[model samples]
Target: MYWSVVFPGMTEGQAKWLLPRAEEGLPGLLGSIVDPNYFISLHVDRHSAETMKEALLLLESSDSSTESKGIARGLLEAVDDWLDAGGKYLEE
Candidate 1:
């Protein structure tokens, strides 16, 4: 998974903390009433860096609710901070 590789040092607690906000925001970006848990389960093992990038692009272009945009931005900022702290996937 991209997150696993990119955020090798992120703790479960951190993920728990961050994911809920992302989930809350994603429905707005999708423009539908989506279940956050289902979304998280789907992406947990399947997401790639490109996927996230595309999602961000979609989020940027989509006519989403303000709450969604704000949450997505916050999630991205948190990820950026983690990356800045030297998080990387372990080489297999």
Candidate 2:
């Protein structure tokens, strides 16, 4: 079965891989978001400040690859800025 939430450019195997990770909360969910717009929406609308904070900390300390961490870092920074700007649209 496919996930109800479709991620851009994601394959069936990737979706399967993402499912369990997503259940682990923001740390798991952040990496699979290929679209910046979706990340912004999730950060602004779904997650709270505290949740994002914890995710940031956890991801920073995680053993994931440098590339993945780098991507997540940038996304988190965008989230921070978006939150600071009162959920304004982030420029691509």
Candidate 3:
């Protein structure tokens, strides 16, 4: 679940609700699929690849250690590169 991925400490219910609200704040059109309203947008468009420069947007604790922050940034950057076209695009 989204919680396990980011907030490994939150309960099941907490994560489900937190993820969408958190996702909305990401930095790109790609990670923009947080809101359920965008399901139709994503489903209808098969090749809507995208990415978000917004990392560390975890709904979990904001005050984390430097190592944790590095890990978060690394994960976000990796996902961004994967979804984006060399970090130079929006959803097509």
Cand. 1 Cα-lDDT: 0.54
- In angstroms, how far off is 25's CA in candidate 3? 46
TM-scores, all models, native as reference: 0.40, 0.40, 0.30
Question: Which run of 10 residues does model 3 get worst, by summed lDDT?
Answer: 40-49
Model 1: per-residue Cα lDDT over 30-73, one tens digit each: 21233444655333212343356458657956899888888777
Ranked by lDDT, the better of candidates 1 and 2 is 2
Tens-place lDDT per residue, model 2, 1-92, is: 11246456776578668777777765544434354445443424434654675687688789988987887788677667756766433452
**Against the true structure, whose lDDT is highest?**
2
Summarize candidate 3's per-residue lDDT along 1-92 as a digit string, tens digits: 02113333555467567667666776442232233334322221112322233434561247888788787777566555555434333363
lDDT of 3 at 8: 33
Q: Candidate 1 deviates by what RMSD?
A: 13.4
